[model samples]
Target chain A: EAGVVQSPRYKIIEKKQPVAFWCNPISGHNTLYWYLQNLGQGPELLIRYENEEAVDDSQLPKDRFSAERLKGVDSTLKIQPAELGDSAVYLCASSPRASGGASDTQYFGPGTRLTVL
Target chain B: AQSVAQPEDQVNVAEGNPLTVKCTYSVSGNPYLFWYVQYPNRGLQFLLKYITGDNLVKGSYGFEAEFNKSQTSFHLKKPSALVSDSALYFCAVSPVYGNNRLAFGKGNQVVVIP
Candidate 1:
């Protein structure tokens, strides 16, 4: 079985430019998530989706960050007018479903490294 | 709110020796814990999880974690460490239900000396 897939494994953009990362989760998975990992740090969740609905995105910077999971299979995380601090690895993950308890394991993509200069 | 804490910033162990990486968590409800490993330039890989029942859960790559409810800790352990085991390890926790959001610890970098 194929694992989660992400595009543009590396990205470089200037501050104030727009950047987007794409994610295609494992087929049949209903829960998708977007996370950010800074250097020497663990993954921090930016958004979470249960199908097409974003159930949690409180951590996302609403002014510059936006995400969409259309059709509940593929997802896109976007950053408008990016800041240098936005430079980090953007990771996407998916789980089979959300109805289960929080113990469910999430499969992760290789991630896209975003460098904002 | 749920949160995870990995006390060590780095752990060094010689190959073939035992290894342990400590982690603790705080949650309002029953805790659902997980351990993930990340190699250089790669995303996080699931190592193990503790939901209920058994305190000791074995997972991929000969990795195991002992869940101590009394101490609110879940430390990753390996009997015989391998050089390949060198990587960044993260501990995550979440409540039994609600938002289903995961709270991750800063992470522990493991270095296995060969």
Candidate 2:
């Protein structure tokens, strides 16, 4: 089976511009996650989705960052009026489920490298 | 609050020698620990995990980790290092059956030299 897939491996935008990244999880996976990874740091959870519902988004910057998981298969993460601090890798991952004795190994995508000028 | 720590930023090992990468975690409940490896410009690949049973868990590409509840550590090890094993390694943990949110360490880069 194919692993997680992401589009536009790199993105460059101005500080006040908008940028978006896309992700497609593995087939039959029921959970998807969006994470931000600053250089030299680990990935941090931004949002998580179980099917089409976003179960957790506490860490997401609602002021400018928004995400959507339409059809429960593919997802899009958008950042409007990007800040220089927003320059980091945006990683997408998926798993089978998040409950009851299930394996919780997440499959990650190559990630989109976003640079804000 | 769940958190993970990797003390070393990089680990160097000669090829054919044993290697180890250290990781420690703190969580409220029982821990679900995982190890992942990432090659250059690639996504992270699952290596191993420790859920409940045995402390020693074996994983992909000769990698294994020992879960120590007392020390709160889950260090990854390999019996014999290979040049291809050089990559960035991450240790992550989530509280048992808790919110599926994972706390990850900063990651450790392993270099295997010939």
Candidate 3:
């Protein structure tokens, strides 16, 4: 089976501009996640969706960042008026099992690297 | 809330030698620990996980991790190092009952000298 897929592997934008990243999860996966990875740091969970419902989004910056999973298969993460600090890698991951399971192993995509100048 | 810590910034090992990357985590109840490897310009790949059974869990690419409840640690180990194993490794943790939010460590860069 194909792994998770992401679009626009690299994106460059000036500060205050809007940027969006898209993700397509593996077939039949039920859970999807969006994470932000800063330089030299591990990924931080921004949002998580179980089917079409966003089960976890406490860490997402609601002021500027928003995400949507229209059909529960593909997701889009958008950052409006992005700041310099928003420059990082945006990663999307999916798991086959339900949420809260210890056996759910998340498969990641080749993240979209955003550079805000 | 749960969190993870990778104590080392980088680990260097010669080929054919044993390799180790240290990781520690903090959680309220029973913890679900995981290890992932990331190559250059690639996504993170699942290596292994420790749930409730044996402390020693084997994973892909000849990687294994030992879960120590007493110390709250899960360290990745490889019996024999290979040049292709050079990459960044991340340790993650999540509570068994919460929203299944994973907390990841800063990641450790491993360099295997050929």
Candidate 4:
């Protein structure tokens, strides 16, 4: 089965420019997540979508970051006026729906590496 | 709040030698623990998980983790290290009642010298 797919394996932009990252989760997976990873740091959850509704986004930086998952299939994460601090890898992951109170392991994408100057 | 800790930033071992990476977690209730590995220029891959049952959970690439409930630690171990096994390892955890949100440690880079 195909794992989560992310576009533009890499991106380089100047500070203040806008950037966007796209992700397509594995088929039949009902949960999607976006995470940000800095150097030597583990991926941190930015947003989570159960279908088209974002159920968890408390960790997302609302000042310049926004995310949307339309039709509950593909997702997009955007950062306007990107800052150097925004440079990091944007990862997308997915998992099957939880059943009977059991947790499912997540499958991750190759991730989009973004660099801001 | 839940958290994970990888005390060592890196672990070095000779090929064919045994290796271990330490991880400790803090959470309420029965915690769900996991280990993930990341290769250069690639995304993290699930190594293994401990939900219930056996304290020793085996995972991909001949890696295994021992869950010590009393110590609040889940340490990843391998009987024989391989040069190909060199990568970044992360320990993640979620509370039993959490909405499946994972808290991860910074990560431990494993170096298997050939």
lDDT of each: 0.93, 0.92, 0.93, 0.93
Candidate 3 residue-wise lDDT, B1-114, digit = tens? 899999999999999999999999999898999999999899999999998899999999889999999999999999999999999999999988776888999999999999
Docking class for candidate 4: medium
Clash count of each predicted structure: 0, 0, 0, 0
Instruction: Compute the lDDT of residue A88 as modeled in candidate 1.
Output: 95
The segments of candidate 3 whose C-alpha lies over 4 angstroms from its true place after superposition are none
Q: List the candidate numbers ranked by DockQ, top first.
A: 1, 3, 2, 4
Tell me which of candidates 3 and 4 scores higher on DockQ. Answer: 3
Residue-wise C-alpha lDDT for candidate 4, range A1-117, written one tens digit per residue = 888999989999999999999999999888899999999899999998888989889999999999998899999999998999999999999988833232679899999999999
lDDT of 1 by residue, A1-117 (tens): 999999989999999999999999999999999999999888899999999999888999999999999898899999998999999999999999866636789999999999999
Between candidates 1 and 2, the TM-score winner: 1
Query: What is the alpha-carbon lDDT of model 1 when measured against the actual structure?
Result: 0.93
TM-score of chain A of 1: 0.97
TM-score of chain B of each: 0.98, 0.98, 0.98, 0.98
i-RMSD values for every candidate model: 1.1, 2.0, 1.2, 1.9
After superposition, the stretches of candidate 1 with alpha carbons farther than 4 Å from their true spots are: none
| Local accuracy of candidate 2 as per-residue lDDT tens digits, B33-83 | 999998877778899999889899999999999999999999999999999
Candidate 3, A18-107: lDDT as tens digits? 999999999999899999999899999999999989988999999999999989899999999899999899999999876665558999
- After best superposition, candidate 2 residue B108: deviation in angstroms? 0.5
